[model samples]
Every structure is written in C-alpha cells, then in structure tokens.
Target: MAPPKPTAAAMADPSPWRSPAQRGRDRALKREAVLKAAARLFNEKGFHATSLDDVARQLNVTKPTLYHYFRSKDDVLFECCRMGLEMIEAAAATVPGSQASGLERLRALMEQYAEAMTMDFGMSISRTPDTALSPENRAELRRLKAQIDRALRGVIQSGIEDGSIAPCDVRTAAFAIAGALNAIAHWYKPDGPLAPAEIARQTADFLIQGLAPRTSERRQPKR
Candidate 1:
C-alpha cells in the first residue's frame, strides 16, 4: 500500500510557502518584480488609468497571468499598502529589544520608519493616485494602517513608562507620530537631497528631545 498521505500540519510545515524551495524563491522574486512594476505604472498613471494589462505589459506578462498572483489591481494595491504598514510594525517591534533608552529607541524606530517609507514599494502606496481603488481595498488599507498606529503607540507607551519619553496621552502622541511617518511615504525619494538615514536621524533627534526624560529622576524614588 502507498504511504499514508501527509497530514495537513505536515503538509503545511517545512514552509508551506513553497514545496520546491527553488520554485518558491522564483515565485517570490517574480511576485515582487510584478508588484514593483505595478507600483511604477500605477504611480505614473493613476490607478484608474492603470490596469492589470498595464502592469502585465510592463512585466511582459498577460493579464490572466497577473490575476493568477493578484485577484485584481486593487489586490496589488492592497498588497503594497499592507507591505508598508507591516514594515513599520516589524521595525518598531525591534526597538524595545535594543539597549538604547526608550526615547532613543523611539527615534531609531521613527528613523527606520522613514527609511522604509522612502523605499519604492512604500512610496507607491502613498504617492500613487488610487482614487479608483474599490471601497473594500481602501477600507482594508485603512485598517492595516491602524495596525501601524497601534505598534507605534506601543513604542511610545514604552518610552513613557521608562521615563525616557515625557508623559502624554499615548493615543494622541502615537497618532501624531504615525501621521508624520506616513506622510514621508508621499514625498520621500531615493534621489532626494537627504538620504533616508540622514532624514531618519534628524527626525529621531527632534522627536527624542521632545520625548526624553523630563524629571531627570526615577519613578520609584531614591532611598
């Protein structure tokens, strides 16, 4: 008798993202390339003006093939937005683990957030004209955006607790930071006068001053 079929967990394991590692890698690379091409086309020609055909043409593929990876153009756009927010979340998560003070960590996180926004993929979401994105995609994009906001708030809260950041309404502070960082995605560029690192540093410097410990004393009090 043939060996028993693999269980769902077993099949899912070892990277269900790909069974053939090489094929998986190639697919991922292609997916990224297509997304990049789509972003470029969409940015240059507003989402309403750009279509799957446009993206496929840029990548030398067919619309059906594009659909195989992305259900629709909105799907692609959603992916781009999701990517930006996810990057922020991932980067912010790294800050608390660093040896830097909470304020320093917040700065670093903001800087990293700016750097991430400067990336082509990230910029595409913010700069690209997507007036045509279905309400569903737009809503999803906004929802994922909240995730970024929440992650940033957590960082701010950590700063508050550590006395590295001045006490403030966490929601307001977090939203402000999120808005500022998100805006960077709209205007930042790789060829801009300032490098991503420099911009990030400057942003960090400014925010740190405002956020750094105010009382110069510990919360528990000295014996």
Candidate 2:
C-alpha cells in the first residue's frame, strides 16, 4: 500500500519553512508552547506519569506536530533543564558592582534567582530533575550546572581572598551557598508570607552571617 499524501498546510510554503529567521521564530513560539504544556503536565502529574500524548493534548496539537518541536519526552525535559540552568547563570550575572563583598554578591544573585525560577513558564532550578533525561541530555545539563557553580565560586573565592568572608574552602562554601539559594525555587510561594526578594534577603543573611568566621571563639595557641 502507498503512504498517505501530505496535507496542503503541511506542504504549503516549504520555502518559508526553510527560512532561518522565520523558522527560528516559529520554532521558538511552538517550543515555548510545548514547554509550558509539558511543565504543567509534569507538575500536575509526576514526570514519569506525563507522556508526549498528554502534552500534545494540552497544546491541541497532534503527536507529529509536537514531535516536530520536540523529538521525545526526554527532549522536552532537556529543554526544561536547559532553561532552569540559564536562569541560575542569568541571576548570578545580575549582581551589582557595588555589592561590596563576595557574600553580598552571593546574596544579590540569589535574590534575583528565586524570582526567575517562579516565572510561571518553566521549572525552577530546585525542582528540575536532571536524572530523568537521557545520558547525553544529562551531560549537557551537568555542563550548564558547572558553569553556574563556577560563577558563584568565583564570587565566593573573591570574598574569602579579600577577607570579607571567613577563610574557608571556596568550593565547598560556594556549593553550600548556591545549593541553599536554589532550594528556594522548590517550595517558594509567591502568595506565602515571604516574597522572593524577602526570601532571598533572609537566605543571604543566614548564609552570609552563618558562613562568616567567628572572631569570638577562643583561639588555641599554636603548639
């Protein structure tokens, strides 16, 4: 038997579909729709429970249409991971020059990060499950995650070097601080008692002071 014929809409303006700029914008809009639908489905139903068919239904599109934008559920999950990683990097970059300390930069960065994670279009860094993706996708996510961690580590190392932060292993300290900040994205509620900025500020205060060197502890005399 012969294969079915392509519809006029599917075959129409094949050249237009070939235009990079036009194709890019169209792909982006369609992708955005796909991600939004996936995120809602993933959140409403756990990641494993949601399928590509459910996502297609949410967008009122066919399976092939969704596949044109995302090859598989793994592909969509990777997009979410990519987006959350970008937000963390973007938030870290938003720190101001006048922040005055490594700790301050960490704090300022976290403040903005909390808000970015809850933007309603995608998953926050905390809630994103990197393990659900294919090994290749997970590796890509690890690369992006490393980038964000390095940025925060730079600021934390600077603080430690400048005496603004207590002398400590910058890598360990930075990871702890970054982890604390990103965790807010998991449970932070806009309608809850603390707003994003407030949660950020409070988190910063705890981390900054909590991590600072204690000058009051009695020092043991060098043997």
Candidate 3:
C-alpha cells in the first residue's frame, strides 16, 4: 500500500509551519511579554502575593502557558530583577562616550536611573526581596548589583578629579545618591502629579547639588 497521503494542514507545508529562526523569534517575543506582565504584577502586588496565575491572567493566558517560558514564579521574579539591573547598567553604559564634566555625566546616568525606577521592570528591582530568590539567583543578583555600585563610584571619583564635583568620600557620596534614587521606586506612582521625567530631572538635580563644586572652589571672575 502507498504511504498515507498528507492531510490538508500538512500539505500547507511552509505556510503552516514556522522556520526555526521565526519560531525562536516568536518564542522570544512571547517570553518578553510574559516577563513584562509578571514584572508589572510584581510591582503592583508584592512578589509573595503575586502568583503566576495573576501573571497569566494579566496576559489572558493559562498558568501552564507561563511554564513554557519560566521554571517557576521565582524564575520570573529573578528575571524581572535581572531586567531592572540590566537597564540601570545600560544607563551607565551611556556615560563612557560623553565629553561632559564628571558631575554632568553622573547626573545624566542618575536621571536615567530615576526614570528606570518608575518603570515596571525597574520597580521590581527594589520591590522584590533578594531573600526570596534562590541562592544561585541571589548570587547573580549581587554580582549585577555590584557592577552598578562600581559604576556609581567611578563617576564620583571622576568628578572629584576633574574639580566639577566637590572633594568628598566617594563611597559615602555614591551611597547617598543611590539611596535617594532607590527611594523613588518605593514612592513612585504612575498617576502622581509629577511625571517620570520631571521626577528624574528633579531628583538628579537635587542629588547633584550636593556633589557639585562648592562656590569657593569655582574659578573667580577676572578682576
């Protein structure tokens, strides 16, 4: 007997099936959507309170569908945290090519950082408890956190050397600036009176004031 004939669906061949590259792209897009939805839920409701079910419902999918992309709720939370950290890292990356004074460069990065905090993924960075993630994830998170810490300190160091910023303890100044920026995530409300850009600009400016060169240090006008 001849082999069974292809069904109409199978006969469609390339039309009915995606190529490997297309399938990969499709999966990535879907995974990103899942992460974004989960991150928003994590920000609105605490990590412990926001279940995978909530995330699935947010995307109008089944809970099992989420498993296709993530190992578990903790995996989703960890990825959200990673996404937040990576965003801040990307903001820092923007500063290296600049010719601006160190203080100016620092302020630019801080503004981006502040704006990131108001976003869903960035808010997850602070809102999700590090202890809730697996030991491995916590380690990875710490590593990423350390990179951000180094970036902050590098700018402060440059500012002091260039005289654009006051001579101060780099560690202490970086800590103060980062602390203030992190607080923005906690109190930020999308519907608040201040827009994210305004908040970013204001918060960055206020912090930079402390780091700016003191009046006595500025070059005096010619007599």
The candidate scoring highest on lDDT is: 3
Kindly give the stretch of ten consecutive residues in candidate 1 with the minimal lDDT sum.
10-19
Who wins the TM-score comparison?
Answer: 3
How high is each candidate's TM-score?
Answer: 0.77, 0.78, 0.89
Model 3 TM-score on a 0 to 1 scale: 0.89
Q: lDDT scores for all predictions?
A: 0.76, 0.74, 0.90
How many residue pairs clash per model? 0, 0, 0
lDDT of 1 by residue, 1-223 (tens): 9999989998774754545878888888999888888777766676678878888888888888887678887889878767866777788777757466667677878988888877766676677644556888878777877777777787788778877788899998887776676688767766789988888787767767666665646556688
Clashes of 1: 0
Clashing pairs in 3: none
**Whole-model alpha-carbon lDDT for candidate 3:** 0.90
**Candidate with more favorable, higher lDDT: 1 or 3:** 3
Off by over 4 Å in 1: 1-21, 128-132, 213-223
Instruction: In model 1, state the lDDT of residue 112.
Output: 86
TM-score ranking, best first: 3, 2, 1
